[model samples]
Target: MARQVISPGWKVVIGSGIGISFGAAPIFTSGFALLTSAMAHEYGWNQTEVAQAATIVLSATMIAYLFCAWPLDRLGSRRFAATSIALFAISLVVLSQVGPSLSQFYLAAALFGFVGAGTNVVSYAKAISRWFDRKRGLALGLAASAQAGGSFIVPLAAHGIITRYGWSAALLSFAAFEIVVCLPLVAWLVKDSPPADASVPDSGSRPQIAEPEVAEADIGAAEIVRSATFWKLALCFAAIGMSFYAIAPNTMYILTRRGDVTAADVAWIQAIGAIAALFGRILVGLLLDRLHARVVGILTVLLMATSMLINGTATGVATMAAASILMGFAIGGEADLMPYLAGRYFGTRSVSKVFSWLLFAFCIGAAAGPVAFVRLSTLSDSVVTPLLLLSALQIVPVALFLSLGRYRTAPEPAFNLAAAPS
Candidate 1:
């Protein structure tokens, strides 16, 4: 038997995974939880105040996603990724050096968000969309699993370093990893697209099934903005970002408040959640390829709602652990769905810009969710109230997603180029 060959597309997936594994999202979502308590204690700041850093990061990130869309298409992924990763490393270093002032920390968070935008899903998804049409969902799933991998590892590593050395040391180590490891790997393996002649499967390779070639239509920004489907997607994702993401940063706090779970237990629970997320992404991708995307999306949202309800009512370690697993799985599914839906509905011609607008909506929800959660907790003096409310809000996305109807099918040059927004 002959050896099976890997495609350049798969190589781009590998590079995308590695870059994302060490990118800003994981560090913010996982590592920052560990940092929040540590920084709050060290500086005599409230946990809520420290947690505002996430809001700052998301606010800046939305702006960056909007501005970077044109540049990402112009410069291409390789050059754009390299520059952003380098700047992201510097921002991490700056974060590691923050003094007593909360303002200083917030500024660093802003820089972290703005410069690190390229390292997020926008660029990687854009690149992966160019390469694999038949397997785009699975390709994106494999790439996104890296975020779960990072989430699983970052908390453990950061917890260890914070316990032994300090929070700053852990951040500095992350910066070094981005510089020494992520930078070189991304620069070497990532490309904008496959060779022009290599769209078909190689000779002697297993025959791949063909899917609807929506990217052929190549819808532009002007067409996308005018479409009703676009707004539905934006609303769906924004609600997803708000209702689901509210749980991530506050996981440790929620568990600790129970007074029975230890710090190590919390870490292990998060790790288990991340593992579930890893599988969830891959499984959802397979399902998306085989089934209707809206059906899969509705199921994912139900899973998220269930997780929130479990978390709100959890009284024991086992229940909390179960809640975490469900939460992670839903988060993973949403991550995969966002790009998959973007490519499917709008096509790839202006996917990055279109995705940027959707992501901007997501960032808006993300920035507001935690603050809303915290405020509700303070007002009602109960975490359960806010969590249950968020769980109910999942209905909004489920309804919106169902209304997306069918994917667009149009001939090539579907929209006039001259009318596209600058």
Candidate 2:
């Protein structure tokens, strides 16, 4: 049989990728850090205070993920994603209106975190997986690159807008953009798989529709938690997250603190990192499809740790820029690995739920990372100790992954075998 050309499934992959990027950018690391700096300067809030709000947002998101998994699976990806985008846009507007009230800022961030749960990696991972089975790693990486892409544009835009019209106006504009641009695409393009009953197996490299029986074999959140493999994967990701997130919120501050680099320089450096991240996501995605994920994971962890060490000791612009690139590359692979692994090891039926648990660990790391860095900085009156400590701590995940032997592989019944349509 001749191979079929491309399929419409690629549209879903493309749309969800852009949607996730749009939904995540404003509140994610790069954009959020710029906003934090603006708010801190305007309100006289310290680094710890600004970082604490982020911690609150992440912690709330972590909790919300626990409940969102079922809703994501049940409500369908389109509705869930649309709602998440709307809520996120509203939250951005509220954040803009947070003019003299720290309480309002924190409240809005926490709300964003809660509603933003559906916009996380889990939202699109299963949906994309349903569309493409053969190169699922690359598909997920493509989706994740949206986040990297957003990081590039949003932070640069946020910084420029804040510089011109003030932070409030910047946020309002972002909200407007998200509603007008992102929501429509998500509504039009993002969707769950067609019912398995009438599914057709596509020729060529098109993803085969999964068998209902195979999907049904997937365990629930309760069952996943009971398994030892689940916790190991969870903890491993948490450690990676902790190390990377420690630098994310502080990158601008660290680069500019010594007066060697200006705000514009920081923006450019972050943009560079974002670009590197996009490539990293795509590259790792391709690699994961063919290579042992554990090996890929270890390399990513090493890059992250090395970046931390460089950032901790760097005194020049070139060194700081190099550190940023390394960090970005590591993060690109790191974010894609967990979700890909979860669905690979577990079953697709419960991908949203299983990955949600992993996302909770991600959120914990994100929440703890910034505060811990800021607290250590304040206590020690320097950034050195925190960076070094985080760099050293990367070992936890490295060790955990090294021992993640059987967990990375599929269970007794191979899910990969069931990935193709009957």
Candidate 3:
């Protein structure tokens, strides 16, 4: 009998998963509603004002991604992640201590964005890309799913804390979790590349899938920025980030506006969406391994558009729940798609730099979405108009993805699980 051997790439996957689970994107995005509600109630700020906090975080994140790309490529993933996670914890502490001043809240949000930038998918994706080629989609999906996993847990836990102790306590609790748990795991498990000896698998165990040799010429940042494909991808993802952040973070407010739903109901609905996202990412990952990414992306965007339409027209909790499932599934697919596409089109030579610019586009949309949604809601005095507009915006990504053509680099040969050693 032979012992089953696991790839060290899987260790980085596990570590990346844990780090991303507590990363800024998941924590800030998932906890937005609770924080907004608490601050709005305490400070008498309006929806638009609280939404600005999200905007600030995204704006700062955009700047961070632009500047951090070079260092990320230079310093390696583990060091960059450990330092960023530590600072992110401090940002949470700063957030927990904010007073009645809205500026203080914005300041804290800025810190979270700037310092916590490395914790986002960009850092982990670079490491993962170096480690796996054949299973990159599945590997990325598994790791990225942690963002959805965090989304699932944060609301339930934060809501409970905010309900009992307050939003401050919730912030403190998350900060402590980052330091006490996430930081250590990342330092130990996350590696930029596999060990030299570990590159080859045990012949008696499982054969290792080697990283694919990319034949495409490496496109520098200046060249990539000028390419039509880059802009297309940028535009596509910006729309995605906008539509998703606009709706996901505001689910509580959106539903409660109907006068029939309670906070608890919204929480459960979001939880359901998070669960859907978890499966959605993995499923998209599997599909990507077998199908064209453009086809998968277009279909996923259409599904999201449908969810937005359903949500806008929903009159009951049941209808909203159904919309959530579609929304969650689409959101999961997008999460997996971003890095997968970046790696596929750009190759890994300067993936960190390329992905940073792409993520910056996403940040622009994410920063604007919440604020734009609120302003539209104010003008129309209804969630319907803003949501419908979001649905319409999905067309941009669909069209752009259709035009993305083929992968610039060749994909590794498909892995056959059936032929693996027992």
Candidate 4:
């Protein structure tokens, strides 16, 4: 099958639209960090408590992924996704209304976790993969770039709002975006299966997506696992998540504490990162199908290494901004790669569950990376040297991906075995 242009397919278009806006969602990392300032000023909370709050948010998201993981595939992408975004919106509203208690923080974090988990980095890619067959790689990447896209615009919006109306108003504004933009887009664009499937009601009689040049014969979940392809993908992504999570989970705090950056400045830097990712996701998506997917992984790992190193040695605004942009590219490239490769290789059979299980590795990394940086920083009174050393640690995973390349096997097609047509 030929690569489809970015415009076709309701699932791809709408999912991508929702995705690009996701940067500004409530409980975003920037907001989580700013919450520290809010708490400190409003109620005199310490950094440890604030950091604990961020961890709670991450934990909630991890737990929610486990809770909703399977029904996701069974529920179909649209329903699973729309409901989740709405729940996220609601959670944000709740969070914005805290009344002097940390328990309230935990409760709001838990709800945000439940609703927001599936709307994250990978699930949107899976949604596009479910509906499109040909050019699945490009489609998933373009759609997933929404996160980078969101990362770009949302931070600025966060900065503007938090800087002006306060974090409370900022949360409310993002909550509004989730309810108005993301929820409705999901409702309109997504379907349960290929257009040809008999159960896809009111789908307007669209034909199944054209099967591309690549056959699905060996790309199903069962086949993928039997082949070395599955482990290779997982191994690369595990390392990939570790590299990014190391930077993202506590980016604001680190910049503020070590670099003496204001939240507003971090927001601007992150916005620039988002712009870099926009091009990166779009270009990488195009490349994955034309070139070997392994190439994408290799380049992403390399760029991450450079970005981390630049970050380690930098002391000024210029160096930090450069690091953010490079990191953004690496981040966007994989944003497109993870779902695109999985769909291309595994054929979207059990994609949600499989992707979820794989993404749990990100959760583990998310949990560890920030704590690692924080601990190292405390031990040495800062994170600079440790961050630089982490740049070297990233090479281990790149080697792991190289091993993955050696074990690569072609995959077969997958079909639903359990569902009854609606």
lDDT of each: 0.81, 0.78, 0.84, 0.65
Candidate 1 clashing pairs, residues 3+ apart or interchain: none
Where is the poorest 10-residue window by lDDT in model 3?
Answer: 200-209
Q: Per-residue lDDT tens digits of candidate 3, residues 155-259?
A: 888889999999899999999999999999999989887654455221223444444424446677788888888899999889898998888667777989854
Q: All predictions: root-mean-square deviation over Cα?
A: 5.5, 3.3, 3.3, 6.2
Q: What's the lDDT for residue 393 in model 2? A: 87
Per-residue lDDT for 1-422 in model 4, tens only?
55433333654555655744573232464356565566556877665566566566666666666655567757766777777777777888998898668788768766776567867754555556555554555666666666766777666776678778887887888889888887887777665455443221112234443333233343454654676766766666666665666567577766776566777788787888877877787778778756777777778778888988888777777788998888878877866666665555555654565566566655655555655666677788877777777788777667766665431223212342223265
Question: What value does the lDDT take at residue 4 in candidate 2?
Answer: 36
lDDT of 2 by residue, 185-236 (tens): 9888776874454333223332344543354565766887888778888898
TM-score of 2: 0.92
Q: Give the range of the ten consecutive residues with the poorest summed lDDT in model 2.
A: 198-207
Query: What's the true lDDT of residue 309 in model 3?
Result: 95
TM-score versus the correct structure, for each prediction: 0.92, 0.92, 0.93, 0.84
Top candidate on lDDT is 3
Native-referenced Cα lDDT, model 2: 0.78
Decoy 3 TM-score against native: 0.93
The reply for model 1, stretches above 4 Å from the true place, is 1-4, 199-218, 409-422
Tens digit of per-residue lDDT, candidate 1, span 247-326 = 67776777777548876788788888888888898888888777778999998899999998998888898998898889
